[model samples]
Target: MLTINCPWCGPRDETEFGFGGEAHRTRPADPSALSDAEWAEFLFMRTNPKGLHRERWVHSHGCRRWFNVERHTVTNEITRVYQMGSASEAAETAPAAEQAPATAAIEKQGSRS
Candidate 1:
């Protein structure tokens, strides 16, 4: 019974959204260079934290936009959500990426329209 607050569709049941693995996970620049052990670690290893965690999530049943989410696993509370752009956009907006959290971005984007 998890209620996910979609940036576009308001809060909805968790069933409507799909879970993405750990966020901010950058792929190796040269995949072919990595050994089997390294590749396996990248594919299977993850930080299953007890508190706040940043992860990617998609609104499957609503807007269908992929966004970053900060969730608390213990209480199932959503702390923040923001549109996680592609690599180029992320690199270009590094300053904004540092200045505000996802919640602020969501609000600002909402107000502009």
Candidate 2:
């Protein structure tokens, strides 16, 4: 099972979270002006990079809040977890010891205070 680090609630089981989507996606500034193909591209296109991919996740059963995770797709190791709009450079470079504790499942539902 994947151990996802929740920015607000700490490390919890992957079952407690919901995968939002690929991170850093830009929305069309003028959606109404776009053609069907443009809209489709925006909706369907996503980066499937093999390493160091960033993605959004929500702590559903714990904090019920959303955050971003910089994870390695090949190893399924989460390198960093941060808030939605914060800078991630520091977390990305920090050693594993400096990163969030990436184990220990949620003891119970709604356990976070």
Estimated TM-score for each candidate: 0.72, 0.72
Worst lDDT run of 10 residues, candidate 1, spans: 104-113
- Model 2 sits at a Cα RMSD from the real structure of 9.5
- lDDT against the true structure, each candidate: 0.72, 0.71
Residue pairs in steric clash, candidate 2? none
Backbone clashes for every candidate come to 0, 0
How well does candidate 1 score on lDDT at residue 22?
Answer: 82
Could you give candidate 2's per-residue lDDT for residues 37-86 as a string of tens digits? 99998999888999988788999899787777878999998877766653
What is candidate 1's local distance difference test score? 0.72
- Could you tell me how far off, in angstroms, the CA of residue 100 lies in candidate 1 after the best superposition? 18
